[model samples]
Target: MHLILWRIKMSNDNLFSKAEIKYLIKNKDIVIGSFGLAAIILAAMNYGILYLIPGIILTIAALGMRGYKIYKIYERNKKIERTRIKYNFKKIKTMDGYQFEKFVADSLKLIGYKTELTKKSGDFGIDVIAKIENKVIGIQVKHYKGKVGYDAVKEVHSGGKIYKCNEYWVVISNNHGFTRQAKIGAEKLNIKLYDIDDFAYLLDFK
Candidate 1:
């Protein structure tokens, strides 16, 4: 009975794995590439037929259809990637607020920074304490489903000043990415801001 239960668990695990999602993405890309090539060929044939307006219109329509198909495929791939990351994150053992901090600390350690998980509540925006090159660095980690705007960055900068640390880092888990204004704010405050994609890269997720 135990053997049967173990086999069932293994089968269920394999059924929900990301390997299938990756295979589907590969097939979708192949189909998109073939459609793109066909559209290009049709456009080339229609280019010389300046008088055949209908043919030109049909070629343009085909190109647009291919573009829409490719866009949908890319969107689906992004969703799959996000789901995979979320699943991996859930598997790590950490509390709600501590999860992002733990991930940052692990990544920093991987990059040769000595990290300490702090319990200071008044940290305001700061999360992790890191030591590098004989200097203490304050890290503020934010896990959001939306964009990390100027306010979040400003809070981290202020926390950095309060802590009197050598440097400050604001790491956000989710965002539409940084805007030009947010980048300028970071520059002015001399603080480092990392978005979801940048955090993933630093953690060697991809």
Candidate 2:
């Protein structure tokens, strides 16, 4: 598998181009042809009564080989997903606070909201102010590396009240999942919190 991957990398200057597509299609066709030939050979061998044991053993081997191939495919897919997420996170990490703020503001604006970037941190914990229609929304942005605890949620909620905003949003990066207590706190305070994964979805990363 490693050898095949290395060969592919060595041959391809543009993996997404027409040449690569043709190569992939040809490889897939060859694999299907090989599997078909193997099945035919196995079936032909089963015709002889004396060859029953050997045929059964061959079929079992084929099944095991297929299973191993399937497992490898699944593993490769998982690895690809992990790599994609890592790349996205690294890209986000390279962005400064102001850049992230602008990104978020642009994203919101795309969704039809007029946004205001606040340089002066609001006492109520608001980092951004957005007005949709006549409603003002307070936003707290957290570029955290670790878990955003219940306290973070509470602060945003309190800030919403102090700012007299219609709604509150807490945007966090690389934080522990909101626990049950945090959920209850958010519900009680009527504050909405979004994790990094949620932000990615909201921003349409994919």
What are the clash counts of all predictions, listed in order? 0, 1
* TM-scores vs. true structure, each candidate: 0.50, 0.50
Error of 1 at 70 (Å): 19
What are the candidates' C-alpha RMSDs? 17.9, 16.6
Q: Compose the digit string of candidate 1's lDDT tens values, residues 1-206.
A: 23433444457557645555445444544434454455556656775444355444545655676678789777656755674375465443344657767877876787688998777477667788888897888888876666667876788778777777888888876646666777779888898887655565555433
Q: Return the clash pairs for model 2, or none.
A: 147-176
- Cα lDDT for residue 47, candidate 1: 51
Error of 2 at 170 (Å): 0.8
Cα lDDT tens digits, model 2, 14-126, are: 75565565565445434444544565576677754545455455556656666777896776556545643644555668787776766667667766789877775435677
Q: Give the TM-score of candidate 2.
A: 0.50
- In angstroms, the error of model 1 at 159 is 1.3
CA lDDT, candidate 1, residue 26: 43
Over 4 Å off, model 1: 1-95, 204-206
Q: What is candidate 1's CA lDDT for residue 124? A: 67
